[model samples]
Target: MSHTEKEATLYRMSTAEHQCPYGLKTKHLLKSNGYTVDDQLLTSREETDRFKEKQNVQTTPQVYINDKRIGGYEEVRKHLGKPLPDPDEKSYQPVIALFAMTALLAIAASWLAFGSFLSIQTVEWFISFSMVVLALLKLQDVEAFSTMFLNYDLLAKKWVPYGKIYPFAEGLAGLLMAAEFASVISIPVAFFIGSIGAVSVFKAVYIDKRELKCACVGGSGNVPLGFISLTENIMMVAMAVWMFISMF
Candidate 1:
């Protein structure tokens, strides 16, 4: 066949009641890739079902190149040699959202408590609130969190139970600190865990040059093990030390 004669066919749903987005996307993709498309629209539910039955396909937005079936959007991309992005790709979005929300909450709380939005108390509350949020994310699925935590946490790697208990300990310390109560236990807990976490993150990302997902939020999170993880631990350690010094 001549290059000028190259043609593709697309079957998509475009009824009076509904229009398929995938169908539009597939059509756009084909046109952008330089294929002349013979667009076929199924105008009714009955017509769509019949087309699916006749084609022996289960989904809409089916494509054909030179009369050879090329499947849907995903398959078409593969056929065009473009790899689909991984759905589980690592990202800092989850951690970023968590910290942002925690900071906002801390400001609100500090204002209510001391009539000041920006103060040493606000920083302490921010750290405490962040710990609570992170703990809750881990507690959502303890088993999953523990598995991911073990990947790089020095204490969790050595003693498996530490992985399971870490979330609860973090939550307890955060609650106590936020309320300005039980500093005796909360300060020590935060210091010990935060110190261990800082060392572990530094070793994993800087010393060993390992690439891994962070369990600071949870196992399902795609947060990378690097600066964000180190920052979280350092914040906790600083809060613990400041609170401890104030106690004396």
Candidate 2:
């Protein structure tokens, strides 16, 4: 496409950004490309979440090229053939929301059940520690667990298969986490800290388009992988981290 045609083809960009340093570049990009922008500039609770859900955007400075989802700022710069801009520093609003919501839920439950956060914390430590140990063992013992003459659905046929079991291993970790958390546990703090590492792995897996099975509580049967899994894992990690930090 000719430069003018390319420029003409570019439509108004929809962006979700705060009044931050990075947001300035987004504004500059829009102006340079001759595209109008509608930055409603979300700050309050309702608007922020509505903006996020509407765009299905988990990160800041989300750019839609010609109404198609491109990505956040870096992706936009890459597409434009401009030297990729510094990775736009994004707000941790989503992470903060997860933490706040969990705390609120725990506090509400505690009030109704035990009349204090103290009881929740005490029981939570024991349960969390137990789960962490159990999850560790399950991961280390996967071969023995996966075998034992597996059958799909009670057809009484023995099947032995070898497949990478990391998803299940992660799921077991998540499950044990849930079990530990069921006491309305003191917010999954350790899970949160571990989540910092897990998020990187999760992102790599997503970029590679690897199918990951859900080993979380209950089941996620046939669900296409996406942000929810990452979010859940992060929440679990956050709880784990919080608990651990509180201990020190």
Candidate 3:
């Protein structure tokens, strides 16, 4: 019996140059879960390679209970009933978090600026702040954002460069709108881009029925293009129109 029910044998790489983070995590997890861990360290590259060959396994951080092999970090987590994250899983969590954060920011701004939390100004601030944040996400990795944006954006597909310029334009419009500065420039800019975006989103999702990732929350994420994407564009257009109408 190599291991008891409450004992686990963990094989991991521990060298001068590098230590496996997953291996450490597995060891910690085993200890935390009331399991006694027998940590077997592979101190060198050759030793690690030899262990892999001997075990007929490709990776380290292997766990065993009652002499039964339990694979790597992810598999160990499964045995411990604490599964790791699945990267390919499609989720609305990112967008939901963004909206929730922006909503709180909006209310906070309203309280700070007007000593109130609920007002037409609050709504405006929410939209403007969202624009700024959304643009900031895109600006984080413009190349990645552009690569995703071109997948469905009508204008981006035609012009190619519009994808790269979009983040700056959105940010500028948002700042100007938020400050109520340069309305002459801001309103038109917002309306133009917003309208184009709305139409493109509508056509792609509704007309073409092509399910693609939205570049709204930046390209690195897996936010599916749909209702929220449409709403974002519509809000910008509405904000621009409202500002324009108010000028009269």
Candidate 4:
């Protein structure tokens, strides 16, 4: 059929009490695709239920073209030969949010403690708090985090228990750094883990040339396994070295 002849009939739920976002999206999609839509609004729960029963469909936002069923948003995309966005697609949003929040908290704490927002102390606090936040994200689902970590971490691959202990160790190091106490333990811990992490990431991304997800924040994270992961380890190493120098 010609583009001008292409037409769609959309049936969706719209009522005084509620409006379906999916329904709105479907209509917009049809219009964007150059289809003239015959919009059918089911204004009540009974009307929606009856329509579903009559159409033998379980969901709202049903679309049709030339009396041929095109389905909902997902199926419509498929019918138009468009790739549907994967729900499990990787994203850096979580890590970005964690770092942003940590920076804000660090600035607030530094202002309260040292009366300076842009001090060397603020950078220290930011790294420490960021580590703590990242560790907390992993701790939320240790099992999942460990599974992802084992994909590339040398220590985790060999000694599975290291994966389990990693979050706690990171959190302990972060807490110690934040409190400016127990440098004797925290320094070595941070240095050791950071060194190991740096090596593992280098081998995975550089040497092996593998495209993988980072388990730095958590197992479910979509953070890429390169720059951000390396930066995190480098921050730990830097913090450890700084803390050690401050001690002597």
Scored by TM-score, the top model is: 3
Clashing residue pairs in candidate 4, if any? none
- Per-residue lDDT over 135-162 for candidate 1, one digit per residue giving the tens place of the 0 to 100 score: 9999999999999999999999889999
Q: Pick the candidate with the highest lDDT.
A: 1
Q: Give the TM-scores of the predictions, in the order they appear.
A: 0.73, 0.28, 0.83, 0.76
For all candidates in order, the CA lDDT equals 0.92, 0.46, 0.92, 0.92
| 10 residues in a row with least lDDT, candidate 3 | 1-10
> Measured by TM-score, how close is model 2 to the native structure?
0.28
Could you tell which candidate, 1 or 3, scores higher by lDDT?
Answer: 1
User: How much is the lDDT of residue 120 in candidate 1?
Assistant: 88
Residues 7-59, model 4: lDDT tens digits? 99999999999898999998998889888999999999999999999999999
Clashing pairs in model 1? none
Off by over 4 Å in 4: 1-48, 63-84
Clash-forming residue pairs, model 3: none
- Candidate 2 lDDT tens digits, 1-248: 54333331221223354354445576577668766665545555566567677867775556554557666667767777778423333333433444455555556556666777656553443334433443444355565434321211111122233212433444455455545544233344345334543554365456666554322211212223345546545545665665556556
